[model samples]
Target: MPMRGLTILVATGDAERLHTALGFAAATAATGARIRLHLHEGAVALLAAPLSAPNDPARHKAGLPKLGELWEEALGLGVAISLCQSGLALHDLDLEKLDPRLEAQGPVSVMTGLGDDRLVAF
Candidate 1:
């Protein structure tokens, strides 16, 4: 049987949460599973092209990669990334501020469009 695709919903803005979600994507993709990362609420911040300040001291701890490095790894693994339309607006972030590779998707489409894909939340 073919490996299943995964749809990950990331709604938190915290760096640790983002790290966890992206790390999961990396590990899953390494196993040949398709990955779709949906960014909503504060999670959309992860896709910002400009690097955020290195404020999270814990990010430098052993073994864990920085948020930007995780993002690049996910992209390199060909993970399909989407940003929530309303979620972006609510966060007061202009669509252009995000990485151009990320598609803008509405809630209805995000929920219903995922077919037989496993859903994970962060």
Candidate 2:
């Protein structure tokens, strides 16, 4: 089988979606796949330091780990993390205040850099 590359484009700020998307990135990376996580739209809020995890017990019972933990795992696994600059401006967020681990770039730069990777948007 061909090695598959995964690119996750996150566009929502919903805690549940962020949790799920982080899960995907960590899981994919665990399988030795190349992974890239791009935060856009409202999802850019997650790039802030000290991210919040979902508080619902059901999410935990369903086997989803804390979003912050999953994010750390993903980054440790070498998943490239990026945030949209326009998204930050749209939401009135300062780029300097975002997590230093995330690279700030335009959407076109991210998309063009993906090459042949499979893209999954959340």
Candidate 3:
């Protein structure tokens, strides 16, 4: 049977992992599946205003999309992205300064919101 939906939880600060997660989200969303991505722990930094990806240069040189570009594509494909509020506080990041596209939510809400969706962690 096909997946009902997809929920991706990103808890690492690694840029490459974040890139991969967003890529999956974009691809799944393209198939008209409901996609929700939750950024928790150190991964919240990926949505910070000055989005930085140390490895994006190499990916760009290889004719691949940058991290930020992938993120935008995921959002454009109707993926719902959320950033954990506690994670933002842990990083001392102001929610207002992060990407406005992100919905600030608690971990519990992110988890409980998943209804029969396949959960994937990165």
Best by lDDT: 3
Candidate 1 on 1-122: residue-level lDDT in tens? 87788888888776667777788888888888888888887777655544342544566566566777788889888888888887778767787866677788987888897898899988
lDDT (10s digit) by residue, model 3, range 30-100: 98889999998789865555555788889889999998889888888889998888888888888786657
List ranges where model 3 is wrong by over 4 Å.
none
Task: Output the TM-score of candidate 3.
Answer: 0.89
Better of 1 and 2 by lDDT: 2
- Report the alpha-carbon TM-score of model 1 versus the true structure: 0.82
TM-score, per-candidate, Cα-based: 0.82, 0.82, 0.89
* Candidate 2: residue pairs that collide: none
Q: Which digits, one per residue and each the tens of the lDDT, describe model 2 over residues 42-73?
A: 88866654666657465568875667767778
Better of 1 and 3 by TM-score: 3
RMSD in order of candidates: 2.6, 2.4, 1.7
lDDT of 3: 0.86
